[model samples]
Target: MNTRTLIASALALGFLAACSKPEPVVEAPRPVVVFTLASAQVAPAALYTGEVRARYESDLAFRIGGKIVERRVDVGAVVKPGQLLARLDPADAGLNAEAARAQLAAAENEFAYARAEVLRYRDLVAKNFVSRSVLDAKETAFRSATARVEQARAQASVAGRQAGYTSLLADQPGVITAVGAEVGQVVKDSAVVMKLARDGEREVLIAVPESRIGELKKAGRVEVRLWTQPDVALAGRVREIAPSADAATRTYAVRVSIVDPLPALQLGMTANVVLADAAASAGGLLVPITAVFEHGGASAVWVMQAEGELVKPVLRKVTVRQYREDGALISAGLTAGETIAAAGVNKIIAGQALRPVAPARPAAAPMAVRPGAAS
Candidate 1:
């Protein structure tokens, strides 16, 4: 059984071992993703939360103090100019007016009697039947009567104005936003009874930081979207900018006038004002927000490159013009139709071989269904 049999068996075992296929090194397939490179008109813009306000708001108040006898209008009621909104009890005012008229009539009668007496005295004085002193005294009496008549006339005018003050009328046509006085409530002079706002001409008032004021000025026209009506976007022009920054907020008050007549727009409604930059809009590049990561004051996006049939993600410097909800507007260093890793960008390094994975879709909230709607 010797050396020849052992050598033959070993040779056969070695040949079998060599002929048996070693465990095949199976390479995983690269993850393929379907993407459409969309060319969108991206605006480089800064967004701010603003409030819609009426162009004219009036604080209606009573000119005179009195107990409110009647309040015809309530808050949110539409009113026209000169419409009666409230009325104070006019009994006292009427009585004063009557007294003033009666006093004026009495003064006029007294003045007339004094004038007749003065005429009789003057005739007698000319006929030498009355002395010069008596004629002089008569003239002085007539003049006193005339003074009394003038005083009565002045009182009557004041009483007339007081009577008119009893009724509070709307000075302008507007919607009543607030009502401060109630029926039978006593109010002092200059106490605001109601707040009126004009029907149309709405504007968004925003407080922009002082640092961004210059940038905002350069971005002339703004697009305003109502918070309640997000789908509806209205155009607005920069109407005014405050001369000085607010002491408390350190921001400048910027007013944007709404150009369209939006009947649905109401005062105090919240709005989003987007200030567009001209220079940034001229450039064309869109990058994923996740890919554009910041580290140590530098911003970058991961660009995928094909390395030996495998895609490798590499970090590339991107000039971010503006930050948006979905992604950042890239001003430079990116071309259209280029693939970039949307997520897992932090772990990836430049020139490192990566198993190209499909970009993760952003999670969305479930939509609320109304009653009787099909699911």
Candidate 2:
């Protein structure tokens, strides 16, 4: 009786064990591509193309308006101070001068006659021949005539200046960079006839993109190289930076004054401006762009913390100074020798267990087959 009962119990226990669901299998930690923060060298220097220009450029124009009958100098012509660069037709100016002189002569004659009459009146009054009121009237007339004569003389001087303006003269030693008016062209007063670049300090004009403008401002050293002499680098500094971006290009215009510019650095020559940092390690740490994620409107990364052979992702906020094609510069909140998730950051949860893996190397580009080469 005991053997049969034991057999039945064993069968029932076997059936119960088979019917119950097996415990769920524990899953292994998933692999995550991670990047290690290394001591980053300064970002490659930014290069910009620009043109050489004079620090003090002037637009040459006539003080008065007239037809341009003579243009002695063309573009690229160098002139000295008071050198005749161009001229206008002097006939009209000459006629105006002559008319002003004639008016002055007439006014002087009138003033002389009035003075003589006043003197005669004074004498007559002294002799009791003329009344004192008559002498006073003559004196008043003489004063008015004198005033008219002075006014005429002033006008004549202005006319003389106008005549002198007919001949365009260089006020400073410079090279003509542009010519806006030609011979026989009627130009208005103060109209630009040419552009002169004075012989003095030279500068390079460059435009920088808005994104890198801050870097440019904080640049440590600037160097300029002319296209004509690429091998030689001229030291330069930030002379001026546009307060606002350009409307068309959305870039800032920067003027770099060349220090002790060589004679070879001429106007309008193409030049290259290089902006670089002084120290190599000033760039802080560099991390993959994909590794950074936004957390509470601030940049953050999933750092891979190791614990007993297992890596756990810990979210850490970081200060990103700049973003480049290669990576994001970590200026603060991180140090060298830190590991972070490189990609698929959104899929990771804070403190989640993960298997840290090195980033996959980029596939090598296929070599091009040469024509008539072996297959």
Which lDDT tens digits does candidate 2 get at residues 193-247? Answer: 9999999889899998887778777865588888888768888888889999899
| Local distance difference test scores for all models | 0.77, 0.82
Q: Report RMSD (Å) for each prediction in the order shown.
A: 12.9, 14.5
What tens digits encode model 1's per-residue C-alpha lDDT throughout 319-369?
877665435667777766677776666766666666665546732211111
TM-scores for every candidate against the unseen true structure: 0.66, 0.65
Steric clashes per prediction: 0, 0
Task: Give residue 316's error in model 2 in angstroms.
Answer: 25
Cα TM-score of candidate 2: 0.65
Q: Which one wins on TM-score?
A: 1
